[model samples]
Target: MIVAPPDPVVLAGLATTRPGPAGASLLRAGLHARRLLLLKTLLVRVQRHRETVAPAVLRGFEAGWLLLERAERARPDVVRAVLDYPTTGAWLAAALTEPLGPGLDRHLAHLELLAVTAALRAGVEVDLVVDTPGGVLPLPGVGRVESGGAGRLRIDARSRAVRIGGGDGTGSRAVLRRRANGPARTLTGSGPGWRGLRALPGGATRLEDLDPYRLPPDMGIPARAAADHADTDHAGWADRWTAARRLLRGTDRERAIEVGRSVDAVVPLVPRGTRAIGATLSAAPGAVLMTPSAGAADMAETLVHELHHSKLATLHELVPLHRPHPPGRAAPTYRVGWRTDARPVAGVLQGVYAHLALADLWHRAARGSRAPGLPERWRVRSAQRFDHVHDQVVEALAILLESDELTNEGREFARQMRKHLASLSSGRRALA
Candidate 1:
């Protein structure tokens, strides 16, 4: 029988040292776990006929860190086994319940947040490895004990690069690198990746890679025509609108404008959309919604990161629609995501995904402007180093589909995104 999330009894007093093994016993306690495996097989089968979950593009992730956080607490052993060897504190942090106390616990939140935040900040790799023999198991999402495979990740904050081992035994990988410490840096990658495996019976592993420090070809797309549609938040918006309109046109033009709107509307959802772009809920619901924006573009990029929460909400629990927290639990903070203008050389070098892509984009854009290949292009090139800042929403949007944390769309949208991004940023690789 497949084990469900940790028992509240066991969970209330889980060990700090060994969570993985301990969590496995909870599975034995459940009577219908075997049925769940059967259900997974049937559901995956249904996807072959129809679609699985939602399209990855419209959403950012199939699961979010918070959802994973709760599941981990329910099953400590599964987490320990799948996550490799986390520290006692790390495991405790991973097993921590949403604090229903009066206030947010930065210390406890730090552990779980650091696990994911640091992974993204440092570029830790994460992916699924499905095992159909046992049933259909998503990597890191479930453990072998439950018939679903566990996640295999190599986290190195010092190296600033996260490599997902893919719990399903797939070789898919995603990476983020930085060029400096600036806000809104490059986020190069394979774009979105394909779902499940190809028809090898085992499956095809499609990984999107990111090379943040590179620039895509400049296809003479004008950027100034959209000045009329620019958000009137600040002078920077006027400049970026006028500047981008002066440089880009056609598909790039339209995409840029849409991207611009998403980033510019990232005000808090309680306020129901801010100066930033879009706002979507995470598993925690209500308090946190993604808002991706940049100073020049507002908080659109910030909204993108927040939106990831909405996309990955399902992983919060295996059961349906049960709130992850009690009525009084603290909500996931918007601070979980961010954007920057400078490069994140140290972050990537330190192995963090935080603003790593933006950093790489900024550095590359800067270098491209200095290149002798072009004979004094437009003045915009001089400030192009921070171009990634303007596109944070784009990255956020792609993550819903492309990122391992959430696989919302199918391959078709994933491929389209790859082609579009590949065409834009001077041959930068995908986040695949």
Candidate 2:
């Protein structure tokens, strides 16, 4: 695959946290292309290390790859849906990073589940056996199936219908349908051992199941027991998300479009009062782990903030924004004014980029009646938020500009960020 460098103009726009429609499209295309390359690399690595991997796992992976390839030829869109899911990239990163051992085999074998999902969605005929050590088959974007016992799970798919049977004669059947004019595929299951996936009210994002590879490795949550408690409150979650989407579209249609494109799923976290909590994993491009307690405005803001992180993460993968810390030497850290602890240069860069967007968000919110039906108190709070985030962004930008750890591209990016912040500051003063 030919990898093209990101356009400098697009990079600059992204640094300002305002990649317009064209820039956003370019970024998404670049990210998708790179992910496809990563998938190919993963397949080759598994093939190279076949001896170390378990025979069953190896066979599963090989069969899955063939099915995936055939599905891609038949329905590239369906295959892309499975491959482009955020957790697929995270799983690939983990599988590639680990050494050749049981851990690696387990990670690599996840590709079989992913491939099966694609085949089912594409309506390709496939009868494949996959190892489900714990009797649970967690399809990446689809729902999970519990076989009631740990052993081999046989999946037979023909014409968009799939039947999953376990060694103990337990079985279930699900029908997959590709939504009209949308890339999302829905699966409805009957009989025992099937838990269908649920989407938020707008159907734009999936409430992701408890897939072990869903979270980054650093989170350290156990796979089988990592089910989210927030799933119980789907009604409330959907209501807030619908409101959040409205608020976002009201605030800025372009930004709302960006968020919609950037995020595919929300891994709901247990609520912590009314405080909003959100996190994005560099490995997982389109997934956000967020609590469900936030109000519409707060949820909207969190989505925007996390979208910046997601964009920057994808950009970093394509272009080196900051150099890694010197080997055997501790990386320098600095206070970015948002977090209590001092952060490394890379962390500071991420903070600066995300806060820059937040500053823009509140700046627009505070300036007159751009957001229709916004309460007076909301405008007042928006002004306060703008002030806080603007200051934090200024402090973080200074750190980024002064750091020697940045690449030439990174320095240029920081300079563009500083210029953009100056523009926003001038606008604030004009409003005053």
Candidate 3:
């Protein structure tokens, strides 16, 4: 029989990390967490279905459910806490199940997040693995791990290292150091996934191989997108990808990896006129589509922007942040700092949350860059970036606060967001 971990003990780990730059931009993450506990307690009065604990998208995760049931029996409170966060458990399950097309890496990352976070909450070393063609690959989100193959990952949470091989148990195995610094390198084989970050061009792996879904219908269909622009005339794609990687590898590497752990794939689309630099599918949780970027920072910001959409899309599957817009009213849209056109409330929220992430990344990137000789403008620009994006975020939050579409819970979320954003900018004087 699985033994449940005490809630107070697991909860201490949650308290260990607070919201803001220190713990990464899980901005106001605690609000939903606290709200979830309250909601779950109330839901016990009206326990709907066993499926209520999981999202519809995750219904296919039969294997994960088996594992999760074991986890639940062992740590019911921890399981409930992970489920209470709108997307954690669902995303974890969906990742395990291969809910959409490619993105095994994305799925594994979420699984790692679930395992590690649960362990923290449970105050114990938790271990789990995903069944792959080769063997069962470990999922230890906490510590350090290198991922490759069909998203094959080996993370060492404390002393627990992943064993790689077939079910027959005849392949190689390696241990990882969780706190080791510098670039995390993957042991080579098969195609790229998370390890695509470290893979070389013209290798066996192609961008399309890693990100198989070229045109996700949710983002609307487009044409003329290339894998890396290496073979095509679109040198711009190659340049942008290179620069974005440079930024990730150099200054923003650690945090970018932390932020991008949720991203399943980054799909670049051929630019359609002067609109939309990037898009993320609401239906497909981890895929992000991008147009040619203006620069490395722009590309990084775009990833941050679309990742917010990806995250909310996952959470949205579990909870309704706002009531549907009035059926007959013309779809009203609001102005966002990043967009020239007005957007609907949902789009506005996506943009604001995305900007919050962007602002934080830039703030950290400018100050914490390891490489020297970054433009003076970047240091000055950090404050400017924060001001512009924070203003937009505040503006969007105001609308969300005033809208009748928001549920009481939604309003509280917005209130928390507003307060969070305010606290972030509380110390800033007017930028010159």
Q: Which stretches of candidate 1 lie over 4 Å from their true place?
A: 1-280, 283-294, 298-300, 303-413, 425-432
Name the candidate that leads on lDDT: 2
Residue range with the least summed lDDT across 10 consecutive positions in model 2: 220-229
Q: Across residues 78-111, which tens digit of lDDT does each residue of candidate 1 receive?
A: 3333232112222232223324222112222222
TM, every model: 0.20, 0.91, 0.50
> Candidate 3 on 266-348: residue-level lDDT in tens?
55566768754777655444456676676777776676667666665544434456678778888777776677888888877
The CA lDDT of each predicted structure is 0.28, 0.77, 0.48
Question: What is the C-alpha RMSD, rounded to one decimal, of candidate 3?
Answer: 11.1
Cand. 2 Cα-lDDT: 0.77
lDDT of 2 at 124: 74
Better-scoring candidate (lDDT), 2 or 3: 2
- CA lDDT for candidate 3: 0.48
**Sorted on lDDT, highest at the top, how do the candidates line up?**
2, 3, 1
List candidate 3 segments past 4 Å from native.
Answer: 1-206, 209-212, 217-254, 272-276, 326-332, 335-337, 365-373, 430-432
Q: Looking at model 3, report the run of 10 residues with the lowest lDDT sum.
A: 197-206
- Per-residue lDDT for 309 in model 2? 89
